[model samples]
Target: MRIGELGNETGVDIETIRHYEKIGLLSVPPREPNGYRNYETSHLERLAFIRHCRALDMPLADVKRLLDFITHPEVDCGEINRLIDAHLHNIRERLHSMQSLEKQLEVLRARCGDSHIVRDCGILSELVAASHKTGVKKD
Candidate 1:
């Protein structure tokens, strides 16, 4: 099938498919006599695998490594396990950072409530003081 048909069948954007091809994630398929690219069943399966990996938030480099493993099924899965564990560690770090950000925002929000004019807005005052490096501690 043509590139458009392959994209439609795989639910991937044409540009992304082309990018994958350009980046060596997907192989370029043979073209017809009319010069139209003819994708095969293998392309469909590979694209589906890539889409699934992307849905899992796996980076392209990791996806490529996984693809390498797929190409060599005889390799032990220990490295794959290590890669997933590292990804989990990174996710945990981000979650901790996000939680800390939430707490900071909550503290900032508590600086002011309704019924105050802009001049007396405690939140804005705190922000301005912080921007100037006034060393004003949060209460």
Candidate 2:
């Protein structure tokens, strides 16, 4: 089939499919005699795999690494496990940071209870004071 057909089968955009080819994430298919790019079932499968990895929020570099591993099944999987563990650690760190941010926002929200104009808002006052302490004058 053609690029569009392959894209439809894999649910990937044309540009994304092209981008994957350009970025070495997907192999470029051979062209037909009429010069149309010819894609096969293997292309569909690889595109789906790429899309799944992207949906998992895997970085492109990691996706490439994973693809390399997929292509070389004989390789040991210990490194793959290590990579996943590292990614999990990074995710945990981000979660912790987000929780801290939520706590900070909760404190800021609590500073302004139900009633106050912008000028009298405790949250704004605290922000202004904190900004001044940090040498950032808020207008």
Candidate 3:
């Protein structure tokens, strides 16, 4: 089928599909006499696998490693297990960071009791003070 048909069937954007092909993630399909790409069932299946991995927030490099494993069925799955574990660890760290950020925002929110003019805004004042002290404009 054509690139548009493949994208519709897979729910993947045409540019992304082209990018995957460029990056060697998806195999280049054979061209027809009219010069359009002729995607086969194998391409569809591989693209589906890539989409699944992306849905799980897997990095492209990790997806490539997983694809390598798929290509070689004889390899043990211990490495895959390690990769997932590491990703989980990274997610947990991000969760902790987000939680801390939430608490900071809550504190900042508490600075103002009610809406006021920009000149009299406690939150704005605190934010300016913070920026001056840290050299980073964060509130």
Candidate 4:
């Protein structure tokens, strides 16, 4: 099949398919007689794998590393374990930061629960005061 057929099958776009090829994530397929690319079964499988990894929010470089491990299945998988652990740690850190941000926003929101004109808005006053304290440059 061609690029479009492969994209439809994998739910990936044409440009992303081309980018994978360009970045060596997906193998380049042979061109047909009329210069159209002739993608085979392997291309379909590989593209699906890439799409799955991306859906998991795995980094492209980590996906490439995982691909390398595929070629040498007998090697120790300790690195893969470490990579996943690191990714999990980063996610936990972000979740913590987000929770903190939510708390701060909640406090700020409580300051102006009642409707007020722009001049009397507690939220706007707090924001402007905080910005000045942080030395935010006014353009």
Q: Give me the candidate number with maximum lDDT.
A: 3
Q: Model 1, range 4-114, lDDT digits (tens) per residue?
A: 999999999999999999999999999999999999999999999999999888999999999999999998999999999988998899999999999988888899977
- Preferred candidate (TM-score higher): 2 or 3: 3
lDDT of 2 by residue, 1-139 (tens): 9998988888899999999999999999999999999998889899999999888888999999999999899999999999899888988999999999999999999999979678989999999998879995667
lDDT of 4 by residue, 1-139 (tens): 9999999999999999999999999999999999999999999998999899889888999899988898899999999999999888988998999999999999899889989798988888999999889995779
Q: Against the hidden true structure, what lDDT does model 2 obtain?
A: 0.92
Predicted candidate 3 versus true structure: per-residue lDDT over 41-120, tens digit per residue? 99999999999999999999999999999999999999999999999998899999999999988998899989888898
Give the distance in Å from residue 109's predicted Cα in candidate 1 to where it truly belongs: 1.5
Error of 1 at 13 (Å): 1.9
- What 10-residue stretch in candidate 2 is worst by lDDT? 130-139
| Alpha-carbon RMSD, each predicted model | 4.2, 2.8, 3.1, 2.1
- Residue 91's lDDT in candidate 4: 82
Q: What TM-score would each prediction reach against the true structure? A: 0.86, 0.85, 0.92, 0.91
Which parts of model 3 have CA positions greater than 4 angstroms off? 136-139
List the lowest-lDDT window of 10 residues for candidate 1: 129-138
Clashes of each: 0, 0, 0, 0
Deviating ranges (above 4 Å) for candidate 4 = 136-139
The pairs that clash in candidate 1 are none
